[model samples]
Target: MDLITLTGLRVRGNHGVFDFERRDGQDFVIDVELGLDLRPAAHSDDVADTVHYGELATRLAEIVAGPPVDLIETLAQRLVDACLADSRVARARVTVHKPQAPIPLTFTDVSVTMTGTR
Candidate 1:
């Protein structure tokens, strides 16, 4: 299957276990891989024949910025769901990165990844 990948989508959201985290949002980076057959779009050379990645990116940004969840896992699943909402996508893999996690130790980042299929 052909794949369309969107990476490093950044948003500010309140999604964590700590109260302060929920009160004060942090930046989240998301990545998504959408699996589908590209033949139709390739043959037609039409935007409608494929997923409108620009629009999908806007939707994903909304999801990341809209809700307060307790875990990055939840955020990942939500993104997978959103990806599958596009009928052109047969499968989706989503990753959510929490860069400002409340870990006491220094770290580059913490993240959760999830995959879903239709």
Candidate 2:
């Protein structure tokens, strides 16, 4: 299957286990991989034949900014659901990255990845 990928999507969200984490909010980076057949769009030269990545990006960003969750895993699942909402997407892989997690030790980032199939 052909693939449509959106990487390094950053958003501010209040998702974490700690009180301060939710109160202060933090940056969340999201990456998505959508599996579908792009031949129809390629042949027809019409955007209707394929996913509108711009709209998808907006929706994913909404998910990030909408509600507060306790875990990146939950956010990842929500993203998978959103991706599958488009009928053309047969499979979706979503990753949610937490760069400003609360930890005493220094760390670059932490993330949760999940894949879903419709």
Q: Which prediction has the highest lDDT against the true structure? A: 2
Worst 10 residues of 2 by lDDT: 95-104
RMSD of 2: 0.6
Clash count, one per candidate: 0, 0
For model 2, residues 1-118, the per-residue Cα lDDT tens digits are 9999999999999999999988999999999999999999999999999999999999999999989999899999999999999999999999999998898899999889999998
Model 2 lDDT vs. the true structure? 0.96
Candidate 1: residue 27 lDDT (0-100): 98
Off by over 4 Å in 2: none
Best by TM-score: 2
Model 2: residue 82 alpha-carbon error in angstroms? 0.2
Which residue pairs of candidate 1 clash?
Answer: none
Computed on alpha carbons, the lDDT of every model, listed in order, comes to 0.94, 0.96
